[model samples]
Target: MKKNILYLSIAVIIGLIGGYLIFGNSSDSSNQKITEVHDHSEDSTNEMWTCSMHPQIMQQEPGDCPICGMELIPAEASSEGLLANQIQMTENAMALANIETTIVGNLMEGNDDGVISLSGKIATNEENNAIQASYFDGRLEKLNVSFEGQVVKRGQLLATIYSPNLVAAQQELITATSLKQSQPALYKAVRNKLKLWKLSASQIDNIESTGEVRENFPLYATVSGTVAMVMAAEGDYLKQGQPILKVSNLNSVWAEFDAYENQISQFKKGQKIKVATSAYPKKEFDAVISFIDPVLNSSTRTVTVRSTLKNNENLFKPGMFVSGKIKGTAQSAEESLNIPASAVLWTGERSLVYVKPNPNRPVFEMREVTVGLRNGDNFTVVSGLENGEEIVTNGTFTVDAAAQLQGKKSMMNKSGEKTMTGHEGHLGMQGDSENKSDAISTMKMKLPMAFQTAFQAALKPYFKMGDAFVASDASQVSALAKTVLAKMKAIEVGGLGKMEKSHLSKSIAMLDAISSSSDLEKQRAQLVVLNENTVALAMNIKSPTETLYVQKCPMANGNKGAIWLSTEKEIKNPYYGDDMLTCGSVIDSLK
Candidate 1:
């Protein structure tokens, strides 16, 4: 019994040792697997999703961006190696945003000269203009050149005049011819007097031979030209030296460009200029600077630069808009890093650009650059860039927009400042405090049916003026404003309440102010005030016939905000015209 117990104890000890070895290894493997699974779950939870457009939005799960309503994408992990101002983007995002880059090189490399751009209009050359006047007082019997723009040539019969004084003088000449044998000096004096009246020697001799006085004298054009103006008509009496018509020689025309105060230094008399006109877009004409007006137009803040161009083909007409470019000398050629104008973002005085640090990664950083001269489509880099560096030439705004959303350094915001959370940021409330002014007053009083009808009638011309402003037609705007003012004045305010009368009177005063000024910018400024009153009036009247949209442009009135009434919901910004034609939103819709 002692020997059997010893064998059983040895076998049990061996079995226990094998079981411990196998189970210990298995437990270690199971713990290792659990740790790996835990790490993966933590990483997944930490991953963030953001919108490509509105990068400010960050969420744990895939969703849509609240701002732009775009799908959320996996937010790129922040690389510790990147600068604080730098941002990394995915290749797919860059492609979607159409981000493009160009290698910095000699933008004016091949060109030996620099160029100065100019804008102006073709004008009648003053040197070639002529005024046709009558030499003596007479009743105009016939005017062959009846209208402006009539082409006349030298020695062409322009008109016939019946002058009693001329007839008496001709009769005196005939009587003197009969007395020539007795009084030679008197006859010579009479013949010379007729010669002074532009009568040919042959005509005097014929009158003497025929013994008759001509009933009327024919006038001829002294020079070849196009009639600019007709000052006199048939049967009209003109005094001596009175202008009959104004003519301009169309063989050549003047191209007068307005150079801003800052750009006057770039222009010099006798410089060669290459001019192109919208009327003849494919054709280019060459001209030399003839004169520069010493006096600057105070209102326009520009000096007139004049160039004479040959108009033998009559290609250039007066008032035709033209653009010119003056080539610069080799020394004047800009010798600096030049980038495309689209690459730079201008906000107040600050100019910003995006620089890519890594060529392999789609990463860009907002960099402030000092700019020098701007020529055509390029800007000379005075500082802040190096040669051969790649830059975002196109879709720069998109990159800056993304940077702004990320709360990184951007064009509008110099520092990485966090924006307001909800309505404030969405409504662009972070600018000048003056922009916070309410657009309209709360004085709402229903107007009489007569006043409403008249006010509605006045709106036609007002909207026409707005369209003129959108077209950038200053003269048209002024004319339309005048019409609106007239209609406003003609409005019958009888039987209207005191509040309605007050609103109508205020609108009339504003319309008068708008009409009194021909300056488009000044008119637009007044239109802002007019718009506020009109909004109040619309609120009071509530035209039953049409729907009006009260649109607000945040960039107008020096960014203090301006409102205008539009018939359509789509924005047609009149304040900035084509510069920011689609820059506003419908703040209120009324019927």
Candidate 2:
């Protein structure tokens, strides 16, 4: 009985030990799996973040962009599945950019009828123009037409002139009439002489019958038209064959449209045209093409197509703008592929379009397309696209901007050059080295104290303008620019030498360019040029009472770099303003 109890105990203890080892190992394996799953969750949450404006910046966690200071968003997914020239945009980005797409199949199917649109202006018909000239040399006594655009009728009295020669001729005619039977030849000669002065036969006969010599001769208009110009005023002396006024019959006018070289083939003499004008939107003018200019205007790259319209109501006036549409038969209406003008992105000589590779994804690839004729709002695609392919139409520039940011093949950067880092401190101060020579030369040059005072006074408004740019106040910048222009003009250059005056003149010109611009970006761009000229001027004749810091920004003017003058050593970049408030460095100091 004792041996049986002991064996049972031993067996129970062995079973308990085996159970403990099995359960303990199983619990440890389960905990290890849970820890591995938790670590994966943490890794998934560590997605990279980046800025949309400054795409080069990357961060491990969400934060503001270091350069633009904009809130960073999740970085774009790895571009492993994208083509070298393709980019993937999120749906939210597409909505923000207003990007729209359309299938490239039969876009012009119903609309392809070979209708050419043209833009031109109304002009006076040169054929209906006439000039009224004085028939005899005399001094004006009475004038009928007072101003241009006065309506005149044929044989109407235009002016009355007093002439000693006409009086002598009238006296000769009266004397000759007395001896008509004895001297018929002399009488005929005197009558013919009076006819040369445009005198009426009745006037000559009355002078002969009454034996009176008239001193004043009345001039009559030969043509009925509106006076276009009045060359002579009342009491003005006139000479024979001198133009007194110009008249034009507005019963007919010309609608001249410019045709580009490629469009010249579609136009021909006697082609029918329909014209409309903004002045009379409801009315349509119909006419046949009267003439097509044989010579092309090299400067305008256009040829003039003229059509004469009957202006019975005189509605069409010279210099009024008009649009025309030329109706023609299409040579291949079924084979045409046309896209909207907004879809095409032109850079220098290349035309680009963002083509959607897959209808399911937001992946777009930059494509170079061959373009043909330009219809009203569409362009005919010559090649490079196939049917059923989708393409971006609106917001093409936005896509190009993104492509440029991605360092992909874009309209401006066809070679896929890497984007330049324009951050203030990313590159170790690039422009300082180039301006060192200028700074050395400038430090050596000196000007008279009076000239320096005037120059410094002229720069006060400019400094204010820089501050306005820093504040991003466009209106304030415009006002300050004008004030700067005024101060620059008020600068006395009489004390300046020839070279100094020339330099000052160039600087003033650059200032004028900036002051005239209403666009802030354009003003900023002009400011870059103005800074260059101003720096050169300052180098030669810097202010003595104040210290000027010449600052440079590598990110300005499309990353080509720009410089400006500031009074402080700390940089307040005007080009970028709040977007990149501290995006520049002081290149040199001027005193």
Candidate 3:
């Protein structure tokens, strides 16, 4: 009975301990699973969105970046919340920033002629000039065609000249006529003498028959045309073989043109050319090249090309300025893209054009193009683009500005350095340096807000009082000018496309001029103009991105300027000139 009772107790205790161990393990496992679920949720909340190359992008949801087409990453939530300086924008703001995209298409294209407008002076055709000269020594006793541009006809009597030589020749012919009755051989000799004096056979016969001497002889017009040169006047003595007047036949005139050395090859004899004159702006006359001068003019760096035209109305006169075009065919195949010269942003070495994926969107992408022969205003794209690409023509400058702000490729490098591209370097600038004073006057007289700020500070010294600058002080003046310039650089004046950094480079160069200025009065005068120009440029500036695209600092020798003073990673801007420096920013949030 005792052994059976002990066995029952042992069974009950063992059963109780086994049940406790099993229940404890089950509760621990349940707690662990709950913690795992919570950790997983936290991880999902902290997920980030980033680009494969540009990790700066941060998005709440998964999407592709408009700039690089990379998958977006989730932003890492900061313990401090959103930074005050950060560009945290709503979806609407993003749209206003023009952060949009479009699809590309393919299509056929036609060859377009580029119309190059060159400002030139009007001139007369040199070959059409006529000079009338006295055939014998005589005195001009009367005048017929007096003033310049007098029209005359062929064989018309221009002037009567009293000539002793003519009288002597007529007497010799009479003597020969008298001697003919006695000695025929001596008569031939006297007839030859009169002929040597330029006496015609009819005049000789009349003089011989009448036995009279005419003192004044009538000079006939050599050609039927306008008198181009009049050398002899009434009462003026003219020598033998001396030119007294010039007449040209306007029935046909030669159009002489200056052909540049490079363009000389395009011209061939008998090729058709179309000529236009400012005087006759609406009319176009056709001419055929009769000759291309074999020799090139070293001084003008051109070859002379001659084209003949019929001047039936006598409208195309000698010395009348005219311009003409000759169509040239290229040996190679035509290009894929067509663009206007104005559409390209010249960066010194490379030609850049902005392409819009969609016309509805204001933004665009920068494409470096290989240019072929320029027909006129249009440039043929030998490579770098396809057909049906929409290019920005009128508002290229505006589009370029937006690209620069968005940190995309631009016409110039960050240092404001330019690239060499085709014949674009030869084209004139938007602001020509030839008329510096005119451009400066236009800027200062208007006094736009940005220009006022930039110029006021830059010209403060000059405005306050006369100042002198030496070459040694050039760098110092540059520093002061840089201060105001930096501020002006941040502003966007228009929406043309993109601004070339070179445009601003000229403004920056003014600072160097200020430093080197030695004469107070002279330097001050120049500085005034410079200040006005700076102000005007500030007002007209289109994009701050231009500064980034061409960040060329003149002092590039280790002390050179930087494209971005700080890396894209850094959030603070030491370069910002105003409180609104970050306004309208179109950048991705940092993860």
Choose the strongest candidate by lDDT: 1
Off by over 4 Å in 2: 1-72, 109-112, 328-330, 420-591
**On a 0 to 100 scale, what is the lDDT of residue 443 in model 2?**
19
Report lDDT (Cα) of residue 469, candidate 1: 86
Q: Mind giving the per-residue lDDT tens digits that candidate 3 earns over 82-156?
A: 222111222332332233322222111343233221112223455666777777888999988887778898778
TM-score between model 3 and native: 0.49
lDDT of 3 at 183: 89
Candidate with the greatest TM-score versus the true structure: 2
What lDDT does candidate 2 reach at residue 381?
A: 83
Residues forming the 10-long window of minimal summed lDDT in candidate 3: 421-430
The backbone clash count of each candidate, in order, is 0, 0, 48
Q: Rank the candidates by TM-score, best first.
A: 2, 1, 3
In candidate 3, position 278 carries an lDDT of 55
